[model samples]
Target: MHPVCEVPAPGESLAEVGGVNVHAGPAIDGRDRRRLERLCRYVARPPVAQERLELTPERQRLVYRFKHAWRDGTHAVVLHPHDLIAHFDYRKSKLGMAGR
Candidate 1:
């Protein structure tokens, strides 16, 4: 994972250490149409793309490749097909809420 080097807007703070990044971005500008649209598009994007998802060669487990490798050096997640469904089902809401 590369360290986050984004410069935050005024009044916002951005920091990263050892590939972990934390940022408190400026408050949302509801009046900014472009920004609002960008945020909406991001939230509505698919959680996983078909290209990044595949069944393991043995056909017993699924592998999900990440767009970027994690700081821990994990490039993909391996799971049983059933477990994958359960994981997605647990994230039930449009707002990415888990469980209830």
Candidate 2:
């Protein structure tokens, strides 16, 4: 089965995990729903961010780095886990469709 969310590119692995249900769209199964819930809980943990990098101070840009979550030399773009969850969850859906 195809994922509800679009496959992420290199340097965007976090979104890959967080966007799973979103990409899976209408095809999401019970297992996927459960996994998404677990993932949302996991990301709620306080110790998730192992480091922080300033991408651009002028633009107030920063990225939280999760060392355990990334492979060596690969970039993992960070977005708020809740935001990802909301994007995929029905709670934030206006028309009850997955929010891309």
Candidate 3:
């Protein structure tokens, strides 16, 4: 699977929890779709940023950061569950999925 791209901040609402741009909808290519799916698994909660600094204790330091969903939220989602299971089941069924 390809690495997921960093989504633009202003475009947050425009993109679904899975990073599927609403405009692109369900028509996304397989690679992006897989990335979206991976993203979706982590969307139950808000994302948090983590910072890391790399250096040799020298003159310059490189900073890196990334977003991730909180473990509490993920645990909650798993514990409480949701209709997503049924939704996926129906989606794979003859009735076809509702809502892109």
Candidate 4:
């Protein structure tokens, strides 16, 4: 987690009830492979999507939008430039198996 990372509960988008996020949203459907794949995709997605993040006109602040709005109607967030990069995630394989 970033120093200022405050990811909201995913309840707004996936849960039947608004704002009720639990640790694990399970998907165990043996009959529907497609549905099960969709469920897994959400948890596997990166915390931030490139298109979802942008800098202000002056390039001072960072604005990030959620793919789906929260139940309370909040759709985006604003942050300082440094904060945006503080916890940015990247991958580099030391075992030489990354691009193979």
Candidate 5:
């Protein structure tokens, strides 16, 4: 599947992608239904919880790895689907720059 270009805003239950309006309620038939189905499938799917932490961005790649346990410690990083999509887009631009 092709990557989605525009990411919807937070708390946005409905949106229009590639000229197709996706919302709740009854489903229509034909191409519109198919488009809506695709949209629902993509959005309904949960985001990948796994994320790589980068320590450096240079000729030599570096990633941060942690392995420790505390008596009562907690860590959390909240990320929305749009954030991940934007990150990928940013990386693509960086890659293009690296080639130059």
Candidate 6:
């Protein structure tokens, strides 16, 4: 499996890393899908959901951890799929950097 990069933190979203606006859909493309599928195959079961934390009044972050197998060996990566806005509490004020 290829080396996995560290997950970006809230407010640090970038296009190069497949980060998207909180309300947007998944940032992965066809190539990323293939890589993720290969990684899934290495593990006996599906990936695990690590955490879901609030980043802002409107955005939440979801983290998934998975193991990938390659000719060399197995490796682990934590995937950050963010830009998820929670609609229930829209009236709350945005928090500062240290709040989240």
- Top candidate on TM-score is 1
Highest lDDT scorer: 1
- Residues 1-100 of candidate 2 have per-residue lDDT tens digits of 3344545664332223333343323233567878778767765866334445434455444455545565556565645555444554754355444545
The TM-score measured for candidate 6 stands at: 0.15
Off by over 4 Å in 4: 1-46, 87-100
Candidate 1 C-alpha lDDT tens digits along 26-95 = 4678999998888778768887787899988898999999999999999999999888878677655433
lDDT of 5: 0.50
Predicted structure 4, TM vs. truth: 0.40
Which ranges of candidate 3 are over 4 A from the true structure? 1-80, 95-100
Candidate 2 stretches greater than 4 Å from native: 1-44, 47-55, 69-72, 78-100
Q: For residue 93, give model 5's deviation from the true position in Å.
A: 0.6
lDDT of 5 by residue, 1-100 (tens): 3323344554445655444455544445667977878867877775442344442445243342334434455343334545656776776575563222
TM-score rank order: 1, 4, 5, 2, 3, 6
Residues 54-91, candidate 4: write the lDDT tens digits: 98899889899999999999999999977665544222
Residues 58-88, model 3: lDDT tens digits: 5343332223446654312211113434645
Q: What lDDT score is found at residue 64 in candidate 6?
A: 29
RMSD for each of the candidates: 9.9, 13.0, 17.2, 12.8, 15.0, 16.5
Which ten contiguous residues of candidate 1 have the minimum total lDDT? Answer: 91-100
Candidate 1 stretches greater than 4 Å from native: 1-45, 93-100
TM-score of each: 0.47, 0.23, 0.16, 0.40, 0.24, 0.15
* Candidate achieving higher lDDT, 3 or 4: 4
| Quality of model 6 by C-alpha lDDT | 0.38
Worst 10 residues of 2 by lDDT: 11-20
User: Ranking under lDDT, best-scoring first?
Assistant: 1, 4, 5, 2, 3, 6
Query: How many clashing pairs in candidate 4?
Result: 0
